[model samples]
Target: MKAFLDILKPNQLIYPNTVGYDWNQVDVNRPQGHPYYHWLQTNQGEGVVNIDNKSIILSKNDGILITPFTPHKYQSDQFWTTNFITICGYASIFFQKQLGEKKYFVLRESSCVDKDIYNLTNKLDSSCDDAQISLQTYKIFLDILHGVQQVSAEGYKSIPICWEIKNYIDDNYMEKISIKKIGRLFNISPQYIIKVFKQAFNISPYRYLTKKRISEAEKLLISNKDLLISEVANLVGFDGASHFIDVFKRVENCTPLEFRLIYYQGADFNHE
Candidate 1:
């Protein structure tokens, strides 16, 4: 198994600084008791983390953020791929207060956010220049901190109607969906839906639906390999291939064909 550990340089602005990061398979059965704040996530398999003497079982997509000075150790019975980072500085002080005395908390399955972290890590790891690596590492650290804050704030709350609407769109993004239709189905006014949904998610319902459609279209373009842009657009609920191309470029900074080539390399294409 490949393992990566990076110790970051001191940064004057962002404190507390990230001391190091670890990404690899774990084989030891011992405590990881440390002094700096740690954010750990299990990417594959299962593990048990003991935080403050409390043993918590973590499976794939499970994560825990531990505060500085917390007593914690983690071990796995089977193959366990994990990613973690240690942080210290003034920023740690801020997180300490926001996290309260309990210090350790589990993160929900945030696939999108986790993808961002993985992409940033890849960028950091692949860069050869030290300056570029440092900049990328700092960006990744900040992104993880912001993600932690969002996840901590949203811990295990009742599912809101807006979330329900979002989930519905996620499941049926290939079908046309309108705010008015959603309002009628949920027994609410379109105006109220727009207002509350925006307040809760920071994006209007229509925008969210468009993003979902574009995301699905991107996935289809990559997975199907031979799929035409028009076919992908139609499959993702776009009115026309041209409009889909426009939206895809606007959201992804690249056209569908370009994205496919970038990920799939040499690929045959057919225009539908």
Candidate 2:
């Protein structure tokens, strides 16, 4: 059985929908994602949480904060207990922006999570009015955010290489890019780029760029009906139409035209 604290709307900038403690968390799966931010921590045993394409393991004291609308699911690898809180409002948007490009964080510090915090908050909830509830909630939120920022700062040097490479790719994927160019910028070798990029993100830099290009191509095909396949390919950084078609087919299991025909025209996509 699981025990949780629920507070009705507190008429404040930051309020929690629910807070749970020491709960034997059942498997949770939400594909479209929860509407409010979910900040969770492991209290006992081990578990795994998958966010989008990446999976993270939660050991004792480890925590993860999932922002709104992030596809996620979690299950116990063995026995697991956790504490969690969900918060949202205008203030939540401010915090989310503060978190930067990523919508989720696999927090590795105790400061971001406290033990049996729901019990204390539950008592506060019973006695407090809307104003007090709001204040307390905002305080906890602020503390966690501040703690996460500190943890991130301390871990910055250890992380930047992978995130830097990914950020550069994200911003410049539409241009002519090469591993050598990226290596030169980072003062690292092309081989290191291939290996570290793969280790961190589980995909080669070249394939990552290709996938990014193809993703944009899909959007263009759906939205702009006038553009030819060749135009779409060039716009997304592919050199030639044939090459784009070949890569798209290999990756998406359909030609760009077929995808456009199916998704845009509202038909099933198996090319006749």
Candidate 3:
């Protein structure tokens, strides 16, 4: 793996520090961690992040913000690649307040802001003085924070019915559900439900349900390592482990066990 890092001296607006990447197949670990905030954005393949003993899976266009002195480690697959920036200052204080107490945030679909971050980092790299670098880096940090906030706000502004339907599916993914059932609950025809849902979410109701179930199953598999495959299948509304494995493989390009093993390699397991 290869990385390009740049560190700058501290200033009033921000303390700009390293911005770089682990090109591929890199084991990036910080047992003691850094004193400044770190924002890591993945551009390709998958990476596993362990922060304060919590594990997270990051894929393309996903980013994570980690706070100061948090024990964290990350590793990428053969094709995994990322760009990241580390910084702190008064702006960081505001960012932290906006961030709340959470040590990390997983940002999805951040490609739109990636270019700006890259450009800002390049500008910082070319900056001739401490004051210029600090100001530019502070702007980059603010942009990142604002971009995440905008994405979050947009997520809540989807059509009411579509949001309600998605919430319903998420809440009851363990049960068998159909378009007709959803339509009946919402007092709409199944055809209308399908049409508006597709328009709103870009996928059919069934696909959304499957994705919700699979996503929940992934969380369960990661957090509760002792759960049997069949148990996970049942929990996620699949009839059996075989069907669950098939769907998981189709969507993730890896079986449930394979996915689990890749992320939780040394964890103990209870087989069934």
Candidate 4:
């Protein structure tokens, strides 16, 4: 009976099991921090995550694993926008159960996940029965757990660049940064920089930079509905709205308008 009562609470039961599968989008006028359980975050837009001594600029194809109750906050870093999803509560236990004990997990946002998330968001928007959504979300939660576990098991094979690259992107993505800039900053040659970084990250420096820009653009579009699409494009370094749209369509397989409609008009994704 005590356990049953625990399950009835809005905070506990709605999280973890039922919540992990859904996506939530938020925009705060100011910085906000929270104590969360297990949460996975993939940045949809241009922003930076500052937690403890670490900072990460959200880029396309980057995913983050945030441990429970680790105080964290996000900032735009520029006028750029930010977007992401967080899963908390018992659902995090799914990851813990699979991956063993790790304080946090972070994946660089990937274009691969864009479609999956879009589909999940659509399913969430369906005015289907609550029981159905609940069951479906549970399944999705398991899928997310599997994804993180796969990344974890792959070890450095997946993310070979030093974590410092992630940090550098966070602090400097908004700035005009190049491989040469990075190489100079770290006292290395451009050629050596390309070799080591690619060896470590399995991706070239240019790919990393472009991905970062696209990710930031995604966040801005979703989080700041009031902002114009052209503005979002410019904020992320695109020359114009058309260019941004073309790039986004190619990578996400949807036009900017389509993406926005799906994201905003879709159902509210609630965990649990």
**The candidate that achieves the highest lDDT relative to the unseen native structure:** 2
Tens digits of per-residue lDDT, candidate 2, 83-202, equal 788886434544653465677877665643564366436746477664445555655665676556555555344656877887898789879899999999999999988887776655
Candidate 4 residues lying further than 4 Å off, grouped into runs, are 1-17, 20-161, 266-272
Q: Candidate 3: which pairs clash?
A: none
Candidate 3 Cα RMSD after full superposition onto the native fold (Å) = 17.8
Residue 6's C-alpha lDDT in candidate 2?
61
Q: Model 3, range 157-190, lDDT digits (tens) per residue?
A: 5668877887899789999898889988999999
Error of 4 at 210 (Å): 2.0
lDDT by residue for model 4 (220-268), tens: 6655778888988888877788988888776655666665554445422
What pairs collide in candidate 1? 15-91, 16-88, 16-89, 16-91, 32-73
Give per-residue CA lDDT, model 1, range 221-242, as digits (tens): 6457778888898999999999
TM-score of each: 0.50, 0.53, 0.51, 0.43
Q: What C-alpha lDDT do the candidate models reach, one value each?
A: 0.62, 0.72, 0.71, 0.53
Query: In candidate 2, which residue pairs get closer than 3 Å at backbone N, Cα or C atoms, i.e. clash?
Result: none
Task: Give candidates' CA RMSD values in order.
Answer: 12.3, 13.7, 17.8, 16.7
- Answer with 2 or 3, whichever has the higher TM-score: 2
Q: Residue 177 of candidate 1: its Cα lDDT?
A: 89
**Clash number for model 3?**
0
Sorting all predicted structures by lDDT, with the top scorer first, yields: 2, 3, 1, 4
Candidate 3, residue 13: how far the Cα is off, in Å: 2.0
